[model samples]
Target: MGKTIAIANQKGGVGKTTTAINLAASFAVLEYKTLLIDADPQANSTTGLGFDLRNIQQSIYDCMINEGQAADVVLGTEMEYLKLLPSHIDLVGAELELINHPNRENVLKKIIAPVKDQYDFIIVDCSPSLGLITVNALTAADSVIIPVQCEFFALEGLGKLLNTIKIVQSHLNTDLEIEGILMTMYDGRLRLSNQVVNEVRQHFEDMVFNVLIHRNTRLGEAPSFGKPAILYDPDSNGSVNYLNLAREILQKNDATKITNQEKILAASDEQRDT
Candidate 1:
């Protein structure tokens, strides 16, 4: 199965959905089957991919609450290889409902299991909070990609995030790993942005990705029209950066091929044994 990652941060306006949608677009461009999970109630990731939010028949809430069938909620996006499991505003209440369930933390994990082997990657755009929804995302994910916006108070909410990850690792899912911490909306012209970048790198060190996404107008504009920067303005710096991120993802996963193969074999054996 391909790696499943949650693009998460408790702090809002840090571009978590932006990164999730664009990254999924990037993966689709590489001919990889990518499923974008809109775990957030805002459903920005769903609209950002050009899916009409108003006319949805089935939503992620239906699947999350066990009211609707899974995978049937998938909507075809403008991109050929990208599919979106759209969310609705009702997802805001899903956390409270999920909390009472036996596998509250792993609600999403169980939902994703049946179709985990179908895609090359599954990217979840988590809500900007440390609530049950975020924990659900963390529990389901194989890895977490943090999108840290370069600005003041950037690290203010991170301690809580790390603690939540730790809690999930210990009690919810042990295989969860930090895939890469990305620095987004970087403005080299601003000293503060650079400072945030440096400070974060000092703490994360090699765990931080080498790539840094600079602020670009096209990046901000694409979502307004419901398109990824790649298709909206393919030549823009933001588009290039996301494409580069896909290449980075491929390279990193390629280096870990042996481990992935072992996982596939193990999964196969488990199926046979069952």
Candidate 2:
């Protein structure tokens, strides 16, 4: 089965949507069959990937509310290996609508379960809230990638997010893990930025990604043009950082698979010798 990762942060302006769009695009460029799901009502991920919200006929809201199949709402993006489950503004009402529904937490999980095996990676862009929609995304994902801004108030509200993850792990998804903590909008020249980075590294240690996403004008401009930074300006710092992040993720997963296989082989050899 494919791995489902949620790009989540309950804080706005943290580069969550940017990471989701560019990272998913980077995975596609690397030849992985990837699917990007826009779970945020803002629909930024949908538009960032070059889809016009006004023209969307079917979206994730339909699948979540009207009993529509997730596959039916999947749309082809410009990238060959990248697909998108577009979101609509109507998703804002999902939280209230699902209040009385049974198993609302797992609704998104059930909707995407049927197509989970079809892609190498599925990326969910969560809204900036710890509401039911975000809970559903967490319940559906195998792991979460948090994009934190390198600012003075960066660590603010982090405890709540960690607590939410712990709650989901204990009740909703036992296998859920924190993929990595990404530091975005970094400026090496600024002392405050450097201090924030050092503080985060000191706290999270190896959980923080080594590749920092530097503040770049092109990164900010790419979404407005409806394209990923890599596609918009391949040589930009934003594109380079995201590409490095993708490489790190792939290497980490590959190492894990190798370790698991080695353990299995060692077990088999021990049984034979006995």
Candidate 3:
């Protein structure tokens, strides 16, 4: 089965959508069959990928609220290996609509079930909130990637987000894990940025990703052109950082797979001996 990762942060302007777009694009560039699900009502992921909101006929809103199938709504992106389940502004009201539904937390999980095995990675770009929609995304995801801005206010509300994750683990998805905390928009010239990075790393240690996404002009401009940094300017620091991040994630998962396989083999050997 493909791994489902949610790019989540309750705090806005933290580069959550930027990380989601670039990271998913990086995975695609690396030849992984990837699906980027725009779970945020803003539809930034949809537009950032070169999609026009006016042109969308059906979207993730339809899938969640109208029982629309993912296959019908999924759009092929400029990258051959990447696909997108676009979101609509209508999703703003999804939380209220789903409130009374039975097992509403699992709606997104069910929506993507049929298409899960078709890709190597499915990345959900969650809304910047701890509302029901984010809860649904968390419940559906196998893991989450938290993006923290490299600024003075970076650590603020982190505790609340962590608490929300713990609650989801206890009551919704026990298999859900935090992939890592991604540090974004770092400026080496700024002592404040350096300080924030140091403090977050000190607190989270191994849980923080090693690659820091630096502030790049191309990275910001690419969105306006409806393209990822890699497609817009492959040589830019923004593109390079995201590519490195993708490779790091791949290496980590590969190590986990090897460890799991070794455990299975060890178990089999014990069984044979017994």
Candidate 4:
């Protein structure tokens, strides 16, 4: 089965979508079959991967509202191992439309079920809100990546988001785990940025990712040009940071797999002795 990770942060302008696009692209570049799902109505991920919204025949909205098939709506990207389930402005109204539906929180989960196992990783780009859509994304995901911006108000709304995650864990997805807290937009030259990073690390400790995504001009410009930083400029700092981030995640997951296997073997040995 594929691991589904939602890139979520209730705070806006915190590099949430940037991480979603580039991280997914980096995974694909590393030859992992990856699927980027644009759950946000903004469709930034769709366009960031060189898709034109105006030309999109079907989107994630269709899958959620009209029960469209994910495999049919999925589009191939420039990268061979990467695919995209595009989004549209129509998704803005899906929250209201699904309000009274039976088991509404599980809708996204069902939509992706038919196609989930086909990829090595599924990355979802969630909107900057704790609304129903975000809830749905969280419910569907096996884990979430919270992107925290390195700035003065870095920890402002973090508590609320964590509280929400707790509620989801309690009531919805019990298997859900926090993938990691990613620190973004760091500027080492700014003392305030350094302080923010230190404070967050002090509080979150091992939960935060080691990679610090610096403020790179190429990263910002790539979206406008309809390409990820890696494809746009592989040598750029932004590209390097994201690639490192991807590698770190892979290593962590590999370690987790080994640990799980050891536990299983231990259980089997105990059973045999008994």
Off by over 4 Å in 3: 255-274
Tens-digit lDDT string for candidate 1 (1-274): 8679999999998889889989999888767889999999999998887777789878989988965655787888888889899989999999888877886777788788888898989999999898988898999999999999998888878888988899999998999999899999998999999899999999989888888888999999998899999899988889878877877877887734333433554477589899
| Model 4 error, position 104 (Å) | 0.3
Model 3 steric clash pairs: none
lDDT of each: 0.87, 0.92, 0.93, 0.92
lDDT score for residue 228 of model 2: 94
Give candidate 2 regions above 4 Å deviation: 255-274
Q: Choose 1 or 3, whichever is better by TM-score.
A: 3
Q: Write the per-residue lDDT of candidate 2 for residues 182-241, one digit (tens) a residue.
A: 999999999999999999999999999999999999999999999999999988999978
TM-score of 2: 0.92
Residues 25-133 of candidate 4 have per-residue lDDT tens digits of: 9888877889999999999999998898999999999999999999999999999889999999999999999999999999999998899889989999999999999
Backbone clashes in model 1, listed as residue pairs: none
